[model samples]
Target: MSRLYGDPIEVWTRDGEPSQFVWRDRLYLVRRVLDHWVVAREWWKVREGDPGERQFWRVEASPGREAGSYELRFDTASGGWLLMRAWD
Candidate 1:
């Protein structure tokens, strides 16, 4: 995965699933959610007060005719989101 590393974004959700997201001044509509999972923080490796669990979604998205697979993570503690990776 390509680490985007804290790029802020806007997401739209319906029924608690991501329907679309805005990143880099463009909107990508989610076509399908391929997978979902949660990653709990590693207490031994992570410091206290760091963001807790992360909810991840592997999705297929399209901005008009261009399409790709993307991995997105949501920080449960802070309610912040990241675009972790994109495959062209």
Candidate 2:
């Protein structure tokens, strides 16, 4: 099972894709992207003509020894990255 954190993080990107991420002072390197998708904000929460969308990236990353799966979310409106969930 994955644990949801929704914690803010710092991510480094290459070619508009996450290449590395820092969470809780630890760095993890992205090995490969497992999946990608976009989610639109709830219609009621978004004003007309507002591009309220979030992008999610499922990636296999490793801090050192072995890899773990992580879901990263990018908020277009806030221009922030979050560590949405993680699996060990």
Separately for all candidates shown, the number of backbone clashes (residues 3 or more apart, or on different chains) is 0, 0
Q: Candidate 1 regions off by >4 Å? A: 1-6, 44-51
Model 2, residue 73: distance off in Å is 0.3
**lDDT of candidate 2 over 5-47, digit per residue (tens):** 9999999999989999999999999999999999999887876
Cα lDDT of model 1 by residue, 1-88, tens digit: 4445457778899899999999899999999999999998877755577757899998999888878888888987778888988876
Error of 2 at 56 (Å): 0.4
Worst 10 residues of 1 by lDDT: 1-10
lDDT, candidate 2, at 64: 94
CA shift of 66, model 1, Å = 2.2
